[model samples]
Target: MPEPKEIGHQIKFPNTLMGLFKKGWWEIPEIMASSCLGLLGIGLGFIAVLNYVKNDGDNREYKKVYMIMRPDDPRVPRLKNPVYTQYKG
Candidate 1:
């Protein structure tokens, strides 16, 4: 049995038009495809964080408004005797 390194080295490639250059991570087309996908994920993560922060600030503002409002705002109706009614024809 050949040594692992020797076995790995035994794989030969012809010096063709496509095989002239050495293979590296950046040399592979799949790396570029994955890089684009990673960039999109990073962009989406940034947008999500920005939205979360914006919504957190909005929540703080709404809480402050709620604290300052009067008990009897016409827009805020009180629920009295909450019950479910069934209609029969």
Candidate 2:
């Protein structure tokens, strides 16, 4: 994997956006277009995470046996029925 410095160094690229924009009027629209693409990526990533959480079923809790005893035991009647409850991922 890339080192932290190598990964984070790209943050400085945007620092030159203003300087690059001032270099020519034609570049303004290109810069805006590139920024829009970056925003689109961020929005898509957010939506994907939201959808994953909403549809995820494996992370939920479900009823399961916690104890067992002979069927003829008098305490069998006290055995509580297991139930399920909603779980948010």
All candidates: TM-score:
0.35, 0.34
Instruction: List candidate 1 stretches off by more than 4 Å.
Output: 1-27, 57-89
User: lDDT per residue, candidate 1, 9-77, as tens digits?
Assistant: 444445674453334232577875787799999999999999988655343322333333344665224
Judged by lDDT against the true structure, how good is candidate 1? 0.55
Model 1: weakest 10-residue lDDT segment is: 75-84
Put down candidate 2 lDDT per residue, 37-78, tens digits, no spaces. 999999999998899777652332343635445667775554
Best-matching candidate per lDDT: 2
Q: Write down the TM-score for model 2.
A: 0.34
TM-score of 1: 0.35
